[model samples]
Target: MSINWDDLKVALAIVRHGTLSAAARALGTTQPTVSRRLDALERSLQAKLFDREAGGLRPTALVLALVGGLEQMDAGAFSIQRQVAARDTGLSGEILVTSLDWLGDDVIAPMLARFGAAHPGVQIELINGTRVFNLARGEADLAFRFGSFEQENLIERRVGEVAYALYASTEYLQQHGTPDVGDGFEGHRLVYLDRAAGEVPHEAWLPALARHARIVLRSNGLRAHMAAVRDGVAMAVLPCLLADREPRLRRVALPHPAPVRWVRVGFHSDMRDTPRIRALVDHVVGEFELLGACLNPKQ
Candidate 1:
């Protein structure tokens, strides 16, 4: 009577998500694979776990009876995995890291290149997105985010402060004219970041900065926001380090400087002393000298 931990994970994922397709997504497998695995698990246990319903997969009495134990097992497995990872002294093995697209591409990517040169044996998997990965669940080994981490159980450290300012294309400024600060860009157009990109300190600042400006466009990404500004359609509050590099756009002068946001690196509390994670964290913190110039633009 052998049962695979992976099949149990599939069952738990199905129980959590309530659908084969959704569970497959969480498990990073196909829907058919989830169905097959569920069938096999049922055969092994000689009990049906879920019922097919129009709404979704409904757990049967057998699954309901064992679900709690299954969850405990899952947590225990993750705990053991974290414990083993924490004890690793070698700098080898893959570390999964996540961050926003622009930050990962512009700021961290270059730093990673240098790190790669020094530690050729260390493999890095960097994911760029606005979605927050659960470090406590080991979804990502590390994360770089604009605001403090949501989970208090994780370890967080300040990496750098990012400066932002109003920016407009030379052509847009020529056509619409430069915005007067206090006026809230009343007559001008604004391009805003979509709320879907995750809540951050700077998200609120954009609206306050252009209180009277009409948001003509809303983008979920900096790449699109910067493109809209460069296209001369609308101006936006963009990071100085990034916006300043664009030849097509110029920073809008104002009475008070724009808002600033802090970048924080976070990892699971269990990984605090892990050699690889520590090495990476230390390397990133040490780059503050270089990050300062890249994060905060010169006034």
Candidate 2:
């Protein structure tokens, strides 16, 4: 039986996610499309690939057996594709950089703007979210994230350190007395980072310090947290690089050292020699250098 690779891919996505809606998100397609492709895939193989249940879709034994081979094929295809593209020495091409939403706003976006202005021929796209890009599989041309990259065949570069501290607007401090770490921030209004923001290393630190403070609001975006603080609603842990320069924001005194996270930028080594990759890395690093110690505030 001849199996179309595209249809097999859809089936594999369904297997991975266990639901047509989830598979659609993974494949960047519609739910109907995922259902249709799954149907076509199963029809071509002449077997029941999945059993739909109340919980989700469960792959049949036959389809389960094909899962491993399908993943290998997917990886091999992307590897070959990027390897071939790596041969291009041209400076003018498209590049995708992935970063966390706040980091993108504070640093990555500005760096991209500088790089794009300098190299007008290069097209750039920045995806900001909590999801880390898989560089080896051509998921992103470059990735800026917190911590080190353990992925093989990748070169990691230190971007900068992100220092976070409690901040509140002058108006907020006027309305509600300044919180004291000695009091464990009791009676303070806190704007918390949303739980869905995902694995933040410094996340626990804030609540640890504000053990008694009431959470007035929760936001997934750091920008929203900063805005709320600026509006005199509540205080929140914000990046020093962003909040420090704002005249309206005041850094709250804390007995404990602020949370600091190191940001790293990396790309697949296969694109090491690619002109665009080299240029981008150099441009971003250089731009970050201008920020200097502001990125890493005092303890």
Candidate 3:
């Protein structure tokens, strides 16, 4: 007898999440349902897939060996279903896209607004966060990332390059005076991206230029960093896309150009054949190309 796809999905979820409750949460179902599915799957296969222990559900050796292959099959099956549906319905479905907060708000959202007008039936969901969403695990349909992909099973294309520039409120520049590379930023206060100095290329580069400058404010949130800069709390290295439109902040000329970083659009390779996903990916790349001039225009 062929194994039930839904039962296999339930088993895979339990293995990945480590408990029935967690699997239920991920699958948007009740614990009893998950447990029943897992039981049915094991009985049908006549194998013990998991062994309960203090650490959590530890998959048996047989299960561990089978899981990798099963996951690939699951992803392929999902893609096939999506492709069939897209073919039958002419690409009408919801596509979820995740990206960095600033890009999501300033760039992708506006592009989607125009895209929505053209593809009126296709629903788009945008998830904006600094943390990387797991595409392999099917957390997001697509991702706009600053750098390259970690998985070999992902298709990545460079969408654009984002430039960073020194920006400060008019009042702050007036009071503190802009410092050049040789001046060492000794007297001025600086705002920094919090968490780590090495998280982003721009964040790391800024601190290196002003090693002696006082870090008066630090934040991980892009909006908070912009607010700090706008309120004259400190000067910051702001993305040109975000800083160009803010009237409160003025771009300070640096002795040299800040390094440019690449922005890439990525999706799981398994989903590449799906019509809806392909359409969304093409739309995103086209939108970025169209807006490249606007995103980094010089003042």
Best by TM-score: 1
TM-score for candidate 2: 0.83
Ranking by lDDT: 2, 1, 3
Q: What's the count of clashing pairs in each model shown?
A: 0, 0, 0
* Candidate 1 per-residue C-alpha lDDT over 120-161 given as tens digits, one digit per residue, 9 for 90 to 100: 888888898768898877889999977778885789998777
lDDT per residue, candidate 2, 128-190, as tens digits?
988878898788989998878988989998866778888899998998888977777888899
Candidate 3 lDDT trough over 10 residues, lowest sum: 81-90
Query: What is the alpha-carbon lDDT for the whole of candidate 1?
Result: 0.83
Candidate 3 Cα deviation (angstroms), residue 52 = 2.6
lDDT values, one for every candidate:
0.83, 0.85, 0.80
In the predicted model 2, the residue pairs found to clash are: none
Give one digit per residue, the lDDT tens place, for model 3 in 64-141.
888998899887876675444435345777778898878888877887777777888888889888778777766777
lDDT of candidate 3? 0.80
Give the Cα error of residue 184 in candidate 3, in Å: 0.6
- The TM-score values for the models, in the order shown, are 0.89, 0.83, 0.83
Question: In model 1, which regions exceed 4 Å deviation?
Answer: 195-200, 206-212, 294-299
Candidate 3 Cα misplacement greater than 4 A, ranges: 1-3, 43-48, 85-92, 130-139, 196-199, 268-286, 289-294, 297-299
Best candidate (score: lDDT): 2
